[model samples]
Target: MKEVVYNSDLHFEHKQWNSELAFWEDELKTFKNRLSELVTRWTDKEVLAQLEHYQNQFILHGGVIENLQETIEKHETNIAGHSQKGDESMDVALVKKHSEFRYQMEAQRQIYADLKKEFFRFLSKYM
Candidate 1:
């Protein structure tokens, strides 16, 4: 008969979590650079006009960016409150912190995607 074993010691190790976090961090950095490039390219009048159109459509969506900003701020406040309490379990605290960071990163990613779409749309219009 073959013996089967489960590695219980590997269950809670955070190495994988750390690796994923690092990967997302690098990806976020790349997204930031791409957004900056698009913004920089907006100096062209056609690009600016396209951006304005995009912004108008976005604004019609009830200030989506502002809502995202507010949600991020709320997450930050929750994290800060938890830190100030100083009595929560480390695991719980870490989860909250990680969630807050994830939320911020996701917000950035959304913005980057929107910007990239607008930039490409502008390019297509001019091409």
Candidate 2:
């Protein structure tokens, strides 16, 4: 039988960075648990070392996701400030801010997608 990777997106809206972050965190935790279980049953030094490497990469990416969450929150707050100014006439600055926020979020999401893709490939092939 062949194994396939699973991809999910639970964001109901474009601004749901919080939930998007949680999804990545959950994936890492699950992968860590599975790796630990697999390691206990492995007797080969080479394979154990490889699993350890994956664990370290997972930790690093976990920190990256946390930073992305903070950035998204900051952008949302800044946009909110401009929004509270009311729908006045000609707020070019506000529009620019919103556009930048959306762009940042989209870029972050792509980074996360690549990270998760490699992580799952490791899981399906080794664990």
Candidate 3:
């Protein structure tokens, strides 16, 4: 039997995911600022190379976050349309999409977490 997914449940899940993404976006800003400060304080060739690498990674990650945000916004709009049309629960396709998004978000979170750990370990050397 197909599980019923109400609009309320989808909204709640999207909200939670949006909140997490926002937090990660803010953290990236903080990390970038710290990197700027570190660059200003030191000019060792190796350290500068590592810093540049992280800067690029953060930029890439930021783009990914933006893309995710836009995708979610579109999905929310779709949900709103369904609500307006009086759909009490998601269709199978919508349910599958949501499940796929959930998995994608989990993967992104893990990848970002690993990057954060690596960045911090590098900071430990000079900070």
Question: If scored against the real structure, what TM-score would every candidate get?
Answer: 0.36, 0.65, 0.97
Ranking by TM-score: 3, 2, 1
lDDT of each: 0.50, 0.66, 0.93
**lDDT of model number 3:** 0.93
Error of 1 at 106 (Å): 3.6
- Runs in model 3 with CA error above 4 Å? none
For model 2, the stretches where C-alpha displacement exceeds 4 angstroms are: 1-14, 87-121
Q: How does candidate 2 score on lDDT?
A: 0.66
Superposition TM-score, candidate 2 onto the true structure: 0.65
lDDT of 1 by residue, 12-126 (tens): 2233434444554454455445445566766887666665665555444334444544554554455456557773333444455555655665675566568657656765764
lDDT of 1: 0.50
C-alpha RMSD by candidate, in order: 10.2, 10.7, 0.8
Model 3, range 8-86, lDDT digits (tens) per residue? 9999999999999999999999999989989998889999999999999999999999989988898899999999999
Error of 3 at 99 (Å): 0.7
Give the best candidate by TM-score: 3
What RMSD does model 3 have? Answer: 0.8
